[model samples]
Target chain A: MPLYYEKKHQVQFYEVDITSQLTLSSLLNLVIAASGEHLEEIGVSSEELISRHLGWVVTQYHMSIKKMPEKGQTIYIKTAAMAYNRYFCYRSYWLYNEDHEELIEINSVWIMLDLNTRKMVPSDPEIMLKTGAEEIRRPQKFPRIKLPKEQLVADKSYFVEYFNIDENEHVSNAHYFDWMISSLPLSFIKSNHIKSLDIKYEHEILYHDSPKSYVHFNQENNRSYHKLANGNLTAAECVIQW
Target chain B: MPLYYEKKHQVQFYEVDITSQLTLSSLLNLVIAASGEHLEEIGVSSEELISRHLGWVVTQYHMSIKKMPEKGQTIYIKTAAMAYNRYFCYRSYWLYNEDHEELIEINSVWIMLDLNTRKMVPSDPEIMLKTGAEEIRRPQKFPRIKLPKEQLVADKSYFVEYFNIDENEHVSNAHYFDWMISSLPLSFIKSNHIKSLDIKYEHEILYHDSPKSYVHFNQENNRSYHKLANGNLTAAECVIQW
Candidate 1:
């Protein structure tokens, strides 16, 4: 069994939206931080991996929300590295209120990458052993995100700012959530809440890359589809159920 | 003497820059959040103040930094409402490392505004009394931010997005620091550290306002001047010593 790690966090004012509920992007950051701490506790920190020119790059995420945490709410974040294949690693994260009621559940897939070439590489056996993840022959299956039937409209563009770049020298994955949600109408955003989200990262976005967000909302299914791209190079695609 | 409040915080990855040091904007958010908690404890919380159709608005800030905290560092943030006159209130914030060594100091001026009218109003005696702040006849003084000696150039333009607006229904003041810093060259930002900063807010920027960041750098004084403007209207002006 993989080792489990948990930490308590208080949502700050800067992490919330106008309605006082935590933003999706901030929620992702909190979960990722918890995972980072978990790895560090297991003696397989990101910095140690970076020193060997090997880094973990997220490929996909599937999240379900019962309710978003609000400002000033103290919640517990729990994470565990469940299993790993030759090239892919699977992890799970959970957010719970003080009462121990689950608020959000997220499962993510990551791949080890050679930083020098930015190419996918096999997970090192020594590092994988440190995480206490079980070696699996088969990869975990996630729901596939279908492309929008209608042509998506490029509604907004975002310039990669200096602050957006993370220690990994790439735009943090959480920013993609912000870009996707910003493409929707303010009225719709204020009235609707996210039920579930599935996102897949295709190409990595770098500094100064001006990416445009393409969006399509289906009224019949109450679903929204989003694509972040720089010209023809798509960086990420996401589907949100409202 | 006014009541003071202090809290300890562990810097998280999201709060740091590429170099692992806390970003100036994040530092401001930490300080402001500390003040919010302090006011809440004093029985003059922002919610209570807003219910009466009144709100506290920042007018000016002067800050001096000895060093910026890094990721994984535990630091203490302390704040107090120093004094208040008829129309202006003074507050001070200090950030200290685990050893209690001072890292950053900020002095700010605020005004009570009638939310309905958006007009400046006198200090509410009952609320001010709750803060344990001494009423004074004279307003506290802050450094004057003079206009740039050279013609400022509009280096970058930023569109106010949905997330930029805070609960006050205006763009958060901390974001202005981001816009100003982003106006500088990445090379310069990476090489230099901020020594001091003085900023004065003239008007509030709202959603969808595409404001331009204008900057002027003086080599002799190692000072940079920044102005955020929406067409002919100026939003904020700042000077930073490196």
Candidate 2:
């Protein structure tokens, strides 16, 4: 069985932004969806995991973008399981245009959680074997993202709505990026392009939680840090480099 | 060329709400997308209209929903142009589950606009002839939606974001429904099911415009009326029956 899987998708109208380019949040969603499809093809489907009282939760993500696709364009997304340690698994995703030119590359880390106990678990031997991944082919190690503790540069409050929740019954991870990027000035987004992003999922935002986003920008490094919070609880922290 | 066109789609995770059922706004988007594809198949595509300095603009809509599809389900959307008058073209859409069970029925009215002049135009002879519609098969006329003109019960402001805009360089018609529905209380939406909707598009909301939505619920009729506005200009009005 092949370790890598690829899928083609036609960009829908709703996925495009005002500039007619794909939004960052939607791009992440496409990657996650493709990863799920790949998992299903390998026999470790979400249904199978649920039946075992287990689930995969994303922990860290680092993505670099060369170009953003446009509406009606057909793009290919390729994903593969790179490696797995005792408690975490590594994966990589690549996006290509119709001409086969690579447009984006992403590396992600995930951990298995025991749903019944609500705690982290070691990688299951049978599940890891099904992925067909070679430890020797693992990608370079991902660095931990660091966000400076400082006063907020900008902030916004968002009420979690029905559409924001996923089948997992919590706020989808991609939306945290949405709230972070949206907090930036419109002019800055329209004039500049995002080069790279690093995000760390710290806490899960449940339904009915109105989380406030705090942003801090580092002009010297051209980077931005974001924290999503509900009262004293921090839901997630992210850093973006443009 | 057949007058009816059918397309199948797998419901994605983002299209579902907290209940795992398709959101009403997403359902409307599916219908509108199917209508666009039908037009493309008949050679009256958006490109053709733009080349002729014209565009298709929706004016009114009436939809009735019997059931909402769940995530991961494959649904078939069927659409057709029913009839056309001197200035208006009527269309109908139906959604069916994988088992061929009908779930939704929608009727809509559209008008041709002179893009250069920014005004309504008569239906072009060539365009109408290409649709292959028969006047004898027209559906029942849609009733005008009545909304109370009294004081507003709830209101909220929303800034038009990059993702809200479409290829036309303005807010897409379907997003108006999204904003209107999202304005409702989350608890109410989670517990209740939407049965029918009536909407009328009055004005266009442009980029960078922060429009506010005013809502009034009628306890006696079990209906809600909404008005979207950008300061002095009214963007749209909708009446939803649950």
Candidate 3:
């Protein structure tokens, strides 16, 4: 039998856009929720998926925003293991109309590690067997990132929007990624496998002030260095890898 | 020339899901917000969209979900006029990435609706023109929903999970729809266009009790109906236009 898992999710009124289609972000949300459902179904809670010392960490995803369904569109999500290799585990995703036929696919990889020691751990063989692993491990790889100019520093500023702040009262990581990656081209986005992204905040980005930006890029290593500023106030720095 | 209307929006975290993606509910929130944005960008306000005891109401929508970007994706939206005639006007939507490439597309029709009267009105020519009239009025249409059937009515038996309850302390409408529609085959969902849905809640669905359910389906009309038992007391009637 083909390896498959399916879960049903409802589209709330809030999910609809002017064209009545679900936004791309919302689609990812449903995909995550469905993945949660799958884990829950198999008696693998987020708590269980974690290492004895380390929590689960999502390092990088080379996801394609291929297609989105409409608002109030009932989505059926399917997920399965493609392989467990190298420092990462490969998983595949498919979203389809309720019928479980036509599919929209998302592919990603993740890892298990000792949280306290912060070292990669061999995946639990028992857990892997239960989750249906048929393949071995290999070195993780991704496409190169196309960075912009090598020396573009903060000149234009951005006033933090109220929505940019999350429940944590900080600029959300997702928003930061969106803002950063958006300045680049989709050609770059589609081509790269995000390696590791390290972002550090030197200061809080407030809602009242217009935050300016600084940027640096190196095409050779495919790294992008970024900064956010407001007047002389420095807010944050990020180094993206692919 | 192509019609143009710019909209400004904010990003909220709760609107996103576990995959750390934005959810459909958040997309709907954006739509609502964009309405205000649209008017503001055009040098008007929602106050103008609302006439003397009148407002534009969405009667029906036929849309396709194309793609959902990741969480925190900040997209630019614009509206254009497709057609307008007499009491009806058609609108088109473009969701663009920051670089200005269209990421999502949608089409809809609106009416100069009388709020209190709940009726379409033949508005002034200049007003329609200002809104970007696309074409003359035609029959506003969508997939037809089937009439609901009365199935076995049971009372007081349901399980409410932690996620089922939103901040509102009641079962979310999305979850309600999820359970209501789950009973039917995925095939029905595949073939049918969800024409319309009307639901009224008489009481709160608590997390404590197992809520009862009644199933109803009419294949000819392509609809499945549902009712929830009220604490072994009474039930709420639901109508689904499939």
Q: Which candidate's TM-score is highest? A: 1
**Chain B TM-score for all candidates, comma-separated:** 0.97, 0.94, 0.56
Residues B1-242 of candidate 3: C-alpha lDDT, one tens digit per residue: 33577764334345643334444345544554565455456544545656466565443343344444455466777676567767766666666766677755555555676757766677557655555555455654544423244454442245553333443345544345445544444445434444444444445575434676677676686655667665654334455556
Pairs with backbone N, CA or C atoms under 3 Å apart (clashes), candidate 1: none
User: Which number leads on lDDT?
Assistant: 1
Interface DockQ per candidate: 0.71, 0.53, 0.04
Number of colliding residue pairs in model 3: 41
Q: Candidate 2 docking category?
A: medium
- Model 1 agreement with the true structure over B187-223: per-residue lDDT tens digits: 8888899999999998889878899999999999999
- Using TM-score as the measure, what is the rank order of every candidate, best first? 1, 2, 3
Go through the candidates in order and give each one's C-alpha lDDT: 0.89, 0.82, 0.54
lDDT of 1 at A6: 99
Task: List the candidate 1 regions with Cα displacement exceeding 4 Å.
Answer: none
Cα shift from native, residue B117, model 2 (Å) = 3.2
Docking class of 1: medium
> Please, what are the lDDT tens digits per residue for candidate 2 over residues B181-236?
76787778878887888888888987768888889888888999998887888888
Candidate 2 local accuracy as lDDT?
A: 0.82
Q: List the candidate 3 regions with Cα displacement exceeding 4 Å.
A: A1-3, A16-20, A98-103, A149-242, B1-242
